[model samples]
Target: EGDSFRIDEPIYLYIEPIGYTIKENPKSSYEFGFFADFTIEGEDGKVLGGQKDFAKLDFKSWNFNTEITLTFTYTISFFSIQVFPQYPDLFSHQDNQ
Candidate 1:
């Protein structure tokens, strides 16, 4: 995966969580679920935006599966270089590009 992404481009993520809690379902199946939160930060450590519980996964299986994969997709549309009021020229340069 690259560190840089274009505006409004789709970003894909694959995650594997360890030591997550598993519960027994009423139907004699095992159940597991998780929620994820995310934040977008600039190089200067300023939090640009974020979402709580942006992705959620729940599963029920007959076997206690040790391997699980979670996939998440995100698109950044609201982010803008114009956020920096102190850098008017920077915004203009981006527009010219």
Candidate 2:
């Protein structure tokens, strides 16, 4: 799917973090962790909504693998639509009409 999404549809985002800091655990294993915050903005650049520390990824591995992928999923429902009714039209299929 493209970047544009319907109001009723869920948004799925995948991120790969490179050159992340890796530390050694007490048991001689490698440990790495990451967290993310997100914000939803309108076309006018106004921040409609967001959350801090929305997702956290932590891993302990025997090998120091640099490749990692983080997935984030979100759906806009009652709260966002209720607060920004006008915004939904921008993403809804009806907008094409």
Candidate 3:
């Protein structure tokens, strides 16, 4: 009974893709993956599922020291799956006249 959710809060986090060119490193493999990055045991007991999606950052037009933020949005679903929203950091508002 600890899984509480806020209707107006964001549960998903967006990751921006950084296309860093790979140079030959003597100590590391050319292609490797990080295993089991997240482990959670909050008061909310246990989480059923989660997902991640990212967009490419256009570095050609990026400022050298700019702080960029990527956003991902998701919704909780039944049957152990998360219904994710398309795109990131999207908010709908009526146009101000």
lDDT of 2 at 48: 65
Cα RMSDs of all predictions?
Answer: 7.2, 5.8, 13.3
RMSD of 2: 5.8
lDDT of 2 by residue, 1-97 (tens): 6555667678777778877899998889999999887776655556666778877878999997889988867776544545446654444211111
Q: How displaced is residue 2 in candidate 3, in Å?
A: 11
In candidate 3, list every pair of residues with a backbone clash.
none
| Candidate 2 TM-score to native | 0.75
Give candidate 3's TM-score.
0.29
Off by over 4 Å in 3: 1-3, 6-44, 52-62, 80-97
Ranking by TM-score: 1, 2, 3
In angstroms, the error of model 1 at 71 is 1.2
Q: Give the top-scoring candidate (TM-score).
A: 1
lDDT of 1: 0.69
Clashing pairs in 1: none
Put the candidates in lDDT order, highest first: 1, 2, 3
Question: What TM-score would every model get versus the actual structure?
Answer: 0.76, 0.75, 0.29
